[model samples]
Target: MAMESTPNIVGVDLFCGAGGLTHGLVRGGINVKAGVDLDPSCRYPFEENNEAVFLERDVNDLSPEALAPYLEQGDFSLLAGCAPCQPFSSYSQSGRSKKRGMDWQLVSNFGRLVQGLQPDLVTMENVSQLAGHKVFEDFLGYLKGYTVRWSVVECIKVGIPQSRRRLVLLASKLGAQGLELEYDPAVPARTVRDEIENLPPIAAGEQHSQDPLHIACSLSEMNLKRIKASKPGGTWRDWDPELVAPCHRKESGSTYPSVYGRMEWDVPAPTITTQCFGYGNGRFGHPVQDRAISLREAAMLQTFPQSYKFAPDDETIRFNRLGRLIGNAVPVRLGEVIGKTLVNHVRMTQGEIAVPSPAHHGRLF
Candidate 1:
C-alpha cells in the first residue's frame, strides 16, 4: 500500500533486523527481493512483514557466486545494511577499548560484499560514533568505485521521537549524488510524551487492554515501591536515603538513577535502550503510569505501525527477544526518505525519462 506513491529499483537488505529498513524500502516504492540475516529468528518477521525472501546464514561464509542469482545484474540494485553498533555505542561503560569479535568485524564483512557484488548503489546506518571509528572509515575508502555522501543525523529532526543520532551514508557508482539533507538546528527537541501521550495507559508489567503487542515488563514489589517513590525526570536520590538501592548509595551506583526514575511527560524520553520495557532500565518508567511503556508503544514511538509482526516460530511473544528486535530495527520512516532520495538520484543520473518534446506533451517532470 505504501508503494503506490513511487516505484523502480529492486533491493536486497544485508544484516536485516526485524525488517525496519526493508519496510521503509517497500514504502518508498522499491521492490525488495530478499533479506539476509545470520539469525534464523528474524526469518519470519523479515520475510512476512516485507514480503521478501529471507536467507539464514553467516554473511562472511556466503560467497558472491551463491548470491549472484538473487541479485539483479544491471537493474539498479541497492545493497543496504546497518550492522550492529555495540562496539561503538557510547553508553558502553566498560571503559576505552576495542572489541575483537564477529560482530565487530561485521562491517568489514559488509565491505567484502560490496567488493564482490559491486551493487549499483549502497546505503548504511549506524551510531554517529561510527564516523570516528577506523573500521567505518576503511569501509568508506574501500568503496573505491562509488561516489559516497554522508552525514551524522539526529532522529528528532527527522520525526523519530528519540534524540538518537545515526551516521547515514549513501553511495552510487554513477558519479556523485547530492549528499545534502535538511535539519532544523534550532527546532525544539521531541519528547517521549510528544510521541505517545494519547495512548491508553496500563500498570507496570501489564499489557494494554486492547493491543497484544502493547506488552510491558512486570516490576518486583521492591522495585515497584522504588519507582512509585521516583519523580518524573528525577533520580533515585529523590527517595529517602533508606530507599536508595545499596549500589546507588555506593560510588558505582550514581549513574544508574536516570534509569530507575520516571520519564517527564513533557520532555522527550531518553534514547530507547534494549531494556525499554523494564522500569529499572534507563528512564523507561511511564510518565504517568506505574509501569514502563509497552513493547507496542515503544515501537509506535519508533514509528513502526501497531500491527507490525515479529513472530516466526509461532511461539508466545518473548519480551526480551521482541524488545531487542524492535529496538534494533532502523526507523522505517527514515529509511523511506533515503529510498525516495535514491529513486530521485537514479532517475536523474540515467536521464532515461526526461522533459518530453512539446509535441509529445510534458505532463510529468
Candidate 2:
C-alpha cells in the first residue's frame, strides 16, 4: 500500500482552507497531491503542513484540465471539494441578507468540475442546510451515475469536541465498492476538557509568552464582569441584570441566548464560528478562565492539532483572518474517517480485505 512510486490513492482538495481535510487525509494514508484555495493566507499552512501544492486560483476560473497536472494517476483518484457554504448555512436562511448570490454558485461549479473529471472517488462537506437547496439537489442529481451516500453529521457524534454540524457526501463510480460514508463514532463524544484541558492556563486578557497561539483575546473591563457572571452551560439569562447587554433587553434579542455563554468542561464546546475568539460572539468563553478561548483552543475544537501552524513566524496574528481560517475548517477527525473509509472501500474492492475487517474500521457497504 506504499505510495512512494505507484501511489495507492492521490487526492486534490478543492477549497482546501488551511489543509485541515488534507491533513486528515494524509493521516488516513492518502497522498494529497494538491490543495486549491483563493486565500493566499492559506498557501503557507496548506503547503507547509500537508506538503501538497497549493493553487491560489479561484475554483470558478479553473477546470479539471487545469487541475490534472497536480493529481497523479493512482489506484484511486479522489476529488474532495467543500465550497464556501455560508450562503446555504442555516444562519443565512434565517435572515433577509440570506443569499450573497456570489459564493453559492461555487457549489454548482464544484458539480461542474466533478462532472468534467469524474474521479474514482468524490467527497464533499458543507453546512447541513445545504441539503435543502437546489444547488445541492442538482449536484446529487449530477452524480446519479455513481454510488452515493450523504447525511447530516453532528460533529460531536463523530468524536469531534465541538457541537458543529455538517453534511458529508461520498460518491464513487466503483458501484458497491465505493466507500459508504459513516458519521457515527464508535466511541463516546469527546468533551472540551478531553481536547484542551491540558494546555497551560492564561488569564482573560493575556497571551502566553511561551506559546503565541495560546494567547487569548483581550476583554474590556465591562465584558470581564459579564463573563464573570456567566455560568458554564448557562446562557446570558443567568447573568446579573446589570451585566446584561442592552441588546438582550430588546424583544428580538431575547431569543439569542446562546451568545455570551461559557462552555461546560464535560461537554463539547459550542460550534467555533469565525467570531469564536470574541467572548461575546458565541458560547466561546473558557469554563474557568475569564476569557474567550484562545486561537489555539479554537483550532483544536475544529480538530486541528495544537501544534498546527497557521501563519509564518514573522506574520502578525490578525484575529479576524486566523479566526476565519480556524472556524471554517473541516474537522480533521471527520476527514480522517472519510479517508479511512475510502481506503477500506478500495481494499475491499481489491479483495485485499473482507467485510468484518473493514467493519472494524468503520461502517462498510
Best by lDDT: 2
> How would you encode candidate 2's per-residue C-alpha lDDT over 315-357 as one tens digit per residue?
7778887887887788899888888878877777777666654
lDDT of 1 at 249: 82
Model 1 has an lDDT value of 0.73
Compute the lDDT for candidate 2: 0.81
Cα RMSD of predicted structure 1: 6.2
Where does candidate 1 stray beyond 4 Å?
1-7, 85-103, 182-190, 312-314, 352-365
Instruction: Give per-candidate clash totals.
Output: 5, 0
| Model 1, span 1-365: residue lDDT tens | 23322435788788787798999878876777888877666787787788888987666576766666666733778888887655643211222123434345677888888888888888898888888878888898779978888888777776677768888888888765333343335557667777778778777767655676777788888888888888898888898887787878889887675868787877666677667888777888888778788888788767777678777343566887777777777888678767866776676577544422345221111
Off by over 4 Å in 2: 1-7, 89-103, 182-186, 357-365
| Steric clash pairs (candidate 2) | none
